[model samples]
Target chain A: MKHLDFWFEFASTYSYPAAMRIEKLAAERGVKVRWHAFLLGPIFKAQGWRDSPFNLFPAKGNYMWHDMQRVCQRYNLPFVKPSRFPLNGLQAARIACWYQDAKWLSAFVKAVFQANFVKDLNIADPAVLEQILNDLQLDAEAILTQAQSVESKARLQAANQQAVRLGIFGAPFFIAGQEPFWGQDQLELALDWCLHSEANLSSFG
Target chain B: MKHLDFWFEFASTYSYPAAMRIEKLAAERGVKVRWHAFLLGPIFKAQGWRDSPFNLFPAKGNYMWHDMQRVCQRYNLPFVKPSRFPLNGLQAARIACWYQDAKWLSAFVKAVFQANFVKDLNIADPAVLEQILNDLQLDAEAILTQAQSVESKARLQAANQQAVRLGIFGAPFFIAGQEPFWGQDQLELALDWCLHSEANLSSFG
Candidate 1:
């Protein structure tokens, strides 16, 4: 099976749908998914945007909210417009980076998404994160402390750097080999490519 | 039958794919498609972009080219990288405006897309457009002359203003009732919404 790297930012509105369903979808296709937590702030800044384009342009911003609502409805996903746009995901991303290889990584990611998008909670709030960690029976203090360590922080920085080097400008981007697919809408296509590309590999070898 | 208004700019790359297949797809679903030709230059300017974002952002431009290649291959549409990014579509839009409800409107739209994307021809060239019209058995000189009329030009301007009024900031936008769906990927969803929403109307009545 081919592997896919799912580059996502916790604050990305589109990534919520992808995060909530990626594991099951990838498993169904017998493809492996590597969850990558990265920040989109740097990418936007590089593009000369001081803020999310949604915030900079009022019309586009309004359309995005309604568009997201339609998308959520289509997917039957619970959605509540976050009270704050682009919730700070630094802590969540660090934790996700630290737990990259853990079995509970997907659970933590989905929980964080639900917290921000469904519960409309401030994901940057340590107490909210602690509750999520505690609910999962993880040691909140220990993990949070470890996640903030210089080493873990460096790892996330490297991940964001990797995303940029890969030419990713948005969240919920997928990379299978050299093929990069952006947006939650391309999830199915990405997974299918992973499967088909791998199947063609042995023939080439 | 439910009606869908496809708001497209001739210079928009993604609209090439949608324009090619929309007529057939709409006919199959017993839906009517209203083609709206408009200029995106004015809209982009309103959004404070002096040029297409594809040109303003190199990384995104590179990614879009590859992504478009993948999409075209998937759809089995012939693909070519246009020598000029966003070839001027002013003349095409004017002509499309003049023929908005003509029986050959869809044919002309698809031909123009094919000329720009498949043949990598400049859609702004009157000679190129004249050839396309001649091939379609239309009076090339007469129609081209009419398309440049002040009234036709104003009609195209009005069409573009309407797009902005409806909060469209991108090409390949579709509207059903008050709902707006942007991007070629959203075409299916827009069509489905058109169908389902119409079906629900009689029940409510």
Candidate 2:
């Protein structure tokens, strides 16, 4: 069976769309997904981009907001532009890092995506994340404390390093057998490639 | 009676995909398209980008190539990567400036796109453009001469100035009244907005 590794950031608006759709789409294609949550803030700072490129250019930012609305409409998803343009995704990523189980990872991703895009909550706020945990019936304080553990922090750092090594400079990146696909719109194609690439391998063999 | 203006650059790869699809889609939705050919090279230079941002960043360029392959496959369009990207579009834009009729503009754009992406021909070559003109049953020499006229150059320049004023930084941009939509992928949304905006205006009034 084919598998896709979905690398996403909680603060990423585009990632919200992909997260909302990837699982259902993958199931239809008979492909399994591995959700990998990572922080893009550190990566952006490393690249000297002070903010999301979309925000840096006002026209691009304006267009992106409208574009997201249309895309959300097409997907039949609610889209409320987040109050904070680039929320601190570090805590969410840390939680994701601590919870590596597939089910927990997906739930966390959905919760975070919904919190940012649908609820218009500041994902960086610990209170918002605590509420997310409380709603999920998980131990809010325990998870928040776990997210602050040195091991979890190191794991996030490792994820950021891995993203850089893989040449990712943006959010919503996917890796399938070393091939990287960037952007939410590229999700379907990435899955298709992962599913279809075996034929090329067989031919080469 | 709703019409949307499509601003495109001859050298943009994604624009070819949108250009090939827009007319049919617009017809389906009972909307009209007004094609506006403009140069992005001057615009990028004005923004201090030497080449397409995709090319400037290797990772982005790589992902974009993969993404284009997928988009083309989905559309079932022949998409051989062009050897000369960011092809000198000055002559093409000048010629388009001279020809406002939809028939000539559509055929010329199709020919240019085919030349670059399908045949891998150097679009900057006069001989290649002459061949395209001849194939269209157009007088190659006369068109070429006219495309080079001082008035034609000024017209192209004026179009670029208009793009600057309109806050265009990329190709395949659409304008529906005061709203702007960027990228080939957003063509449908732009068309939809054009069709529905009148209802919005009436409701507001």
Candidate 3:
């Protein structure tokens, strides 16, 4: 079976559309999508950014908001600019990293993006994450406890290290074999690379 | 005829593909393209960037080169990493701006991009611009003289100011009606918007 690794940061606005649709798109291409939730905060800080580049560069941010509106409208994905730019996703990311193999993981990822980008809710709030987990029929309290544990926190740190090693500067990022594709718009191009490049299919190997 | 404004910096990598293909694409869609040659230097400076973001960020620079290869391959356009990245496009831009309404403008724009991104030539060289102009059967010396005049310089400066006012932070940006689409990837989307959008087709109005 062909496989591709998808790296997404929860607070990323473009990741909203990419997460909402990637599974079906990948499945259609006979590709198994590996969901890896990661943090952009560390990567961004390393780049000397004190805030989201969008906030720091007002013009890019202005164009992005307008562009995202069009992107969501085109895809029928509901979008509302979050009340706060780049709400913290540390808690959400820990859960995702810890439960990476859980059957409901993808749903949880999508729901969290929706909560932030669609519902304009602060995803950093425990109650918000708990509500999202409960809505997915998962044990909210238990998962929250585990996600907040030192162990889960370490796993997330490791994931960020791995992402940095992979040279991912943004999300949604994808790795098809040894190739890296960035941006939500590159999602199909990445998958197509996975399907067509018979020479390189051992994603993240 | 329906119309769209194309904003391109001669040194922009993605603009290579966008410049090579936009005319045919727009013509096919019954849309007229208004090519606006502009500088990204002022825009970047305003954003506090001392260099191209691609250069300022190493990881992104690495990803961009790889992605450019794939993009070029997918489009069947020639690709070559210039000996110098982001070669000064100032001289070429001045010519492009001064001659924006000339019949041979589009051909000249494509030639300049081909020179910089494909043939690995310094587009900033007057000899290179002269050669491209000579190839177009235009009087190279006369055009070069006019392009270097104070009036031409002011036009280029004005063009950059206009792009800034329009919220254009990157190239190749497109304006279909009042909509601003950034990057070469958005060219088609911009054209489609021009064809479909009825309420705001006055363009720069």
Candidate 4:
């Protein structure tokens, strides 16, 4: 079996689509995926970016919304433009970090994506997050409290650092050995490399 | 009978893969493609970008190179890093502007992509472009001379201005009426929309 390392940020619009589909696609291809959740905020700040570069450029932002619409239609997924661009992904990322399990992470990601894109909820709001946690039947207070812990903060910082070292500047990135693939659309090709590359395959087996 | 407009830049790496495969894919789906060649250099400059944002950030550039290799491998196409980060696409774009026939533009684009990525030649160089033109059995001097004409230059400018007005900031963008799809990977979805959208398909019949 071959393996793919999936690195994603909760706030990334495109990552939502990829996160929703990657696991199923990988399963069909008989590949294992290791879900790694990280925060892109710190990385962006380090680069002196105030927000997602897409948001900084109005034209790019407009184009992205239209692009997302087309992609969502193709995948038969609902897409509504989020009212807020670059929502605070801290709490969600923290919960993802705390759980660190593939199943929980996947569910959390799907919920967040749906909440932000479909339901148009402000993910940054603790109340909204609490509701999501409650719906998942998880310990909402405990998780939310833990999300603010010093250890949790350090974990996120480390993830950002890891992303920087890996030469990742965008969300929805995948790494197979030294090779890195950016964007959700490249998911299939990235998985293919993991499945066929002798060096990458050996790691999973 | 449905038609989708493909806007591409010769400097775009992923566009190579898309241009090579799109015609066959469109034919299989019984869709028609309209190739729109334009230079992104002016657009980027207009947006106050000095270069491709990928090149502005080292991490992005590094990841993109590796990512493209995987995609090329999956497509079984040759992949090699071009010597120049962003080739001067003005000459090629000018040539494409002269033709409305999709087949000619497609073949020309494929040749230029091969020249830069496979042959590792300097596509920005006039002599190299001359050779490419000669190989294609097109008049090198005449095309080059015509490419310099004010009329051809104005056409290139107009094409770029059209891209910006349509909210496009990236290479390999597609438009189906008012809907826009960015990136080479999104071509299929763009084509699907062209084929399915009542407003667009009506024009075909």
- For candidate 4 chain B, which ten residues in a row score worst on lDDT? B196-205
Clash pairs, candidate 2, are none
Q: How would you encode candidate 1's per-residue C-alpha lDDT over A1-205 as one tens digit per residue?
A: 6798999999999999999888889999888999999999888998889888889887778888887887787789999999899889999999998799999999999999999999999999999999999999999999999988999999999998888888898889998777788899999988888877745332110
Give all TM-scores, in the order shown.
0.95, 0.86, 0.96, 0.87
Regions of candidate 4 where Cα sits further than 4 Å from its true position: A1-3, A26-32, A102-105, A177-179, A192-194, A197-205, B101-105, B199-205
* Candidate models: Cα lDDT each: 0.88, 0.81, 0.90, 0.80
**Per-residue alpha-carbon lDDT of model 4 for B36-119, expressed as tens digits?**
888788778876778897787777776667667766876899988887878887788888887646455677778888988888
Clashes of 2: 0
Candidate 3 chain A: 10-residue stretch with minimal lDDT? A196-205
lDDT per residue as tens, model 3, A1-205 = 8898999999899989999989999999999999999999888899899888889888789888887887898799989988898899999999999999999999999999999998989999999999999998889999999997999999999999999999999999999888888889988888988888776443332
iRMSD, all candidates:
8.2, 7.1, 4.3, 7.9
Tens-place lDDT per residue, model 1, B1-205, is 6799999999999999989878878888888999999988988898789998899988888888887887787788998989998899999899999899999888899999999999989899999999999999999999999998999998998888788888888889888777788889888878877878745332100
The CAPRI class of candidate 1 is acceptable
DockQ (C-alpha) of model 1?
0.47
Docking band of candidate 4: acceptable
Q: What local lDDT does model 4 show for residue A202?
A: 26
Q: Rank the candidates by DockQ, best first.
A: 3, 1, 4, 2
